[model samples]
Target: MASLLDEILFETAGQGPPPSKDFYQFFITKNEVIWRWWKISGRTEFRGTPPEEIKMFHHNFLDDSRFQEQLAVVFGNKILEYTLGLCRRHFDYLERLPDQLLLKILSYMSIQDVGRLSQTSSRFKKICNSEEIWKLTVLGHCDMITEDMEMLAKAMGWKNIFFKFYYKNEHVNMASPAEEEDKANTASP
Candidate 1:
C-alpha cells in the first residue's frame, strides 16, 4: 500500500505601512521553521544600517507555548492563530485529489449529495457544477436519451436540460427564449 503520510509547508511575508516599514518572511517546513524580520530606519546618518534579525526552531523541540510565543513576537496574535488554523487543514487528502478523479467520483453520487459536496470547497463547486458531470448524471438517471435531446443539451447545457426534464410541470414556463420569441413573432401583426 502507498504511504498516506505527507509533508506540507508554506511561506508568507508581510510589510507594515510607511513610517513603520517592517518586513518579515516566514517559512515553515516539516522539520524546521524560520522567521526573518527587518525594519527600515529613516535616519539620514545611519542610511544603510537598518535593524534585521532571524529566528529558527526545529519542529521536534517546539511546544505549543513556545511556538505561539515566537509566532506572536514576529507576526502578532491574529496571524499566529490564522497560521495555526491553516496548518490543521494542510493534511486534507480529499482537497488534494485530482479534479478528473473527483469529478468521476461525484458522477456516481446522487444529485442531492453532489449538491451538498459542492458547498465544501471551491474546487468541488466547480466540478459539481460542470457540464461534463451533469451530462454523466443525466445519462445515469435516464434510461433512454434521444439524439435530439443530446443535441439540445449540448446547446442548452446539461444542468439546464436535466432540471428542465426532471422538474417539469405544466404550469411552469419551460420554453427557451428562442422558442418564446418565435411564438411571439408568429402571433404578432
Candidate 2:
C-alpha cells in the first residue's frame, strides 16, 4: 500500500511483469511524488539491506527524466500525463471524483444541464448517458416505480424508459409503456 502523505491522488504498487524479486511502490500526492522500493534477494550482500525511499516535489518530479522514465515503465502514460498535469497545476479534480459521487451530483442537475455537460467531455457524456444516472433520474421524476415500469426498464434500459416516458415536455399518459415503445419503434425509420 502507498503511504498517505497528506492526500494521495494516484497510487500503485507491485512486482510488475516480473522476473526479479524486487517490490516497487509509488504514489502521487497533491504536492509530491514519493517512490519507495525494497530489495528482496537471497544474496549475502543484499541481506538485511534497508528499504529505500525518494520524495520529490512536483516541479522536481517533472524535471527528472530518470524518474519520469521509471514512472512510464511502472505506471504507463495515462498516469504520467495525469501526474504531469498535477505538477503543472492543470488540475482535473472533477475527473478524479468517485463515479458514485459524480452520479449523485449529476442526479441533482436538470436534464438540460446534463445534456450540455455531456458535450464537455467523453467522461461526462458517458455518465450523463449511463444506466445508473437514468435510473436515478426516473426515480426522481416519478413518485412511484410500478412493476410494469421495472419490467419496461429491464427490457428497454432505464435511459430508454426515461426518454420514452418523460423526456422533453412529454410525460407518461394513460398508456402502456410497451405500447409506447411499439409506437416509438414503428414511428421511427
> How accurate locally, in lDDT, is each candidate?
0.70, 0.83
TM-score of each: 0.55, 0.60
The segments of candidate 1 whose C-alpha lies over 4 angstroms from its true place after superposition are 1-90, 143-150, 167-189
Clashing pairs in 1: none
What lDDT does model 2 reach? 0.83
> Residue-wise lDDT of candidate 2 within 1-189, one digit each (tens)?
223223877788877446668888988887889999888888999999998999999989989999898877776877788788877877666776778989999999988899998998898999999989999999998898899988988899999888777885454344668988999999999
Residue by residue across 98-163, what tens digits does model 1's lDDT show? 778888888888777999999987888898999889887778767877899889987999999878
Model 2 poorest 10 in a row by lDDT: 1-10
Record all residue pairs in model 2 with backbone atoms less than 3 Å apart, i.e. clashing. none
